[model samples]
Target: MAPTIPGFDYQRVQVADGIALNTAVGGSGSPIVLLHGFPQTHLMWRHVAAALAADHTVICPDLRGYGASDKPADPDGVSYAKRTMAADVVALARALGHERFALAGHDRGALVAMRAGLDHPAAITLLACLDVLPTLDMWQVLRGTSATVGFHLYLMAQPPGLPEQLIAAAPDAFFGHFLDIWSQRPEAITPDVRAAYLDACRAAVPSIVADYRASAGIDVAHDQADRDAGNQLRMPVTVLQQDWGALLGFDARALWSAWAPDLAHTTVNCGHFMAEEAPEQITAELRKLMAR
Candidate 1:
């Protein structure tokens, strides 16, 4: 059985043609949509969702190609692009009767949230991105030895066939690598949760690869066009990330400032899986963002 968020109801929401996102809706008051990251599902928001349920309607959804969402194999990688995924999120929120909502995302979901903020500024009142840089800056910072930490990004960005075959061969190990190496508190992700993520990734190998591949190709083009056009996220934005800037020798705040005019960027003292390793802090920061 899939892990359930307390007091939340699960449903499959069709955001695009033949593409439905498996979503969890709970709480009341102002709506806030939370998007989960790679190799995981909405179950990752269990703790934070319950905490925010007291005053906010929390909508947690698996990205279109992850978790229980429909996995469409688009060879061109267009279907899984963050822009399309962002549209899915907006449609999902609108389908739930929310024309405007606060948005928050972690890891891969952060990429989606960023695009949504850029593309549908009217729909997202406030945006919070956790543990990821913008797509363009992300690729820019990855060079030489730094790229080593992001081997999976390059691997999946390949011509498709090989990454799917290799990951499919040992899905658990491939997916579990992030769970093991990225978490400050691995125990926060119980065995059942780990198994659930692995199972989801195993079943959606092609779609997952296509999603990442799009990042290196079409997603970059979209982001670059936005940059060249001087298009920015015209909303109050908050970003929470580990202090990787110190290690990577780049100015995180300076990078984000170009995209968000109204920005609050902070480096958290947690692992990449901040939502799990430090739920209390993540919850507090999100609540603060929504309040703003």
Candidate 2:
């Protein structure tokens, strides 16, 4: 059997016309959905989700193009946009009988949660994003040698064929590169979990690339539009991030404040994969976010 969140029940719920997300749900009161990040599945939340499941109905799903979820083709370059994936998440929650819920996401998944909070304010009671800046700010902050760290973003943002061809040529090396470097606690991801992450990412290369490509294209445009209109996340928002600002030379909290009016930003000491590296701290911060 595929690795799962031990006690949580799993199901595939249709979130769009022909697309359904593989979701794991547990616990009972006050729902809060957790979206997983790149090169990892909903299983990344196994530790955090289980803890939250004690008091909250925790919903963890592989985003539309990752893990066991549906990977739709990006024929129009908008299919894998964060807006589309965010809608998938909102739909998934409603399908499971939640009209409103707190939402949190990590890395790529955090991007989706941010979009959802902007587009569906009434449905999201509170929001938490882990270790990423908004798309607009992200593009703005990277300059000079600092931008080198995000080379994957540039690579996948290229026009279709080449990026896909290159990554697929040596799938493990490409995906594993992030898995290896992004974690401060290497032992946090065991061999079995590492294998699962690699297997899923290898099979979903095209869709995953399309997802990143949209961020460089349509996602940027969406963020730009929101900024132009003074759109902001209405709910109470919590942002947990590594000290990218210290190294990259930008105020992370100030940038996030532009998009989230009611914001509480915390700089974490852990690596990018803080959900796995510091679940206790993540859980505490999340509980605090929801209590707001």
Candidate 3:
């Protein structure tokens, strides 16, 4: 039940990594890649990407493991690190023939984009992070009562077999729980949309688990290495987040500025799923970020 959106051409482009990325392209101008968050696909960017396509060539692709992309086996022999995921974006943009482009991502995608900016600074002209904090700082802030808000962090962080076993036993309940709690306007996610999302989650359980599991282990090592190297985004950064003060009890803007020196942070009264909940606001921020 994908929404019948007008003027989008579904496409698949093969990158150097031997994975063909399933992407949707629309509009016509400078390329701006849009990456989706956890438990969602490029469909999450359908509204915002379509809106931006009026002027900018918007590229919405499912990240490697999540949607219609190749879900290769996760052996430690191959890297499942977000750094490698970031490199996938680099390879993807290069494969699409864009040398320098504007990039943006939400939730888990934001983490990948952040790594892209730090790792491949010259390749990105602008960066936008929607509704996420740095992984390391986020872990630090998850102490005391605030920790309860992100119980899934620990749930997904556990060693392999147990989490996968439990979550697979009740995939809908596991994914649906987040879809239910994360949105301020859960009503925005109609039955059809919810069903589609749950279906994608159920299909990609091991990859999804591996992605989060990396965040808990390998990704943390990467973040700490960057921190040790005194690295930062080093580009104009825009952050849009729902005010989580009542829930997480941390100042979003203050924490963000520490990582991004040239930053513009705005708090929107949306849910954790801000892109779908407030597409207009998110688009406005993207336009402004591009103009900056």
Task: Output the number of the lDDT-best candidate.
Answer: 2
lDDT of 1 by residue, 144-209 (tens): 786788999999999968999999999889999989999888999999888888888889899889
Error of 1 at 191 (Å): 1.1
lDDT of each: 0.92, 0.94, 0.85
Q: What would you estimate as the lDDT of candidate 1?
A: 0.92
Residues 57-144, candidate 3: write the lDDT tens digits: 8888888888787776677813557888888888888877899899999999999999899999999999999989888888878889
Residue-level lDDT of model 2, residues 1-292, one tens digit each, is 5688989999999999999999999998999999999989999999999999999999999899899999988889989999999999999999999999999999999999999999999999999999999998899888899899999999999998999999999999999999899999988888889899999999999999999999899999999999999999999999999987988899999999988889999989988889999999999999999889
Indicate which candidate wins on TM-score. 2
Runs in model 2 deviating more than 4 A are none
Question: Which lDDT value does model 2 have at 69?
Answer: 92
After superposition on all CA atoms, what RMSD does each candidate show versus the true structure?
Answer: 0.8, 0.7, 1.5
Ranking by TM-score: 2, 1, 3
What's the TM-score of each model vs. the native?
0.98, 0.99, 0.95
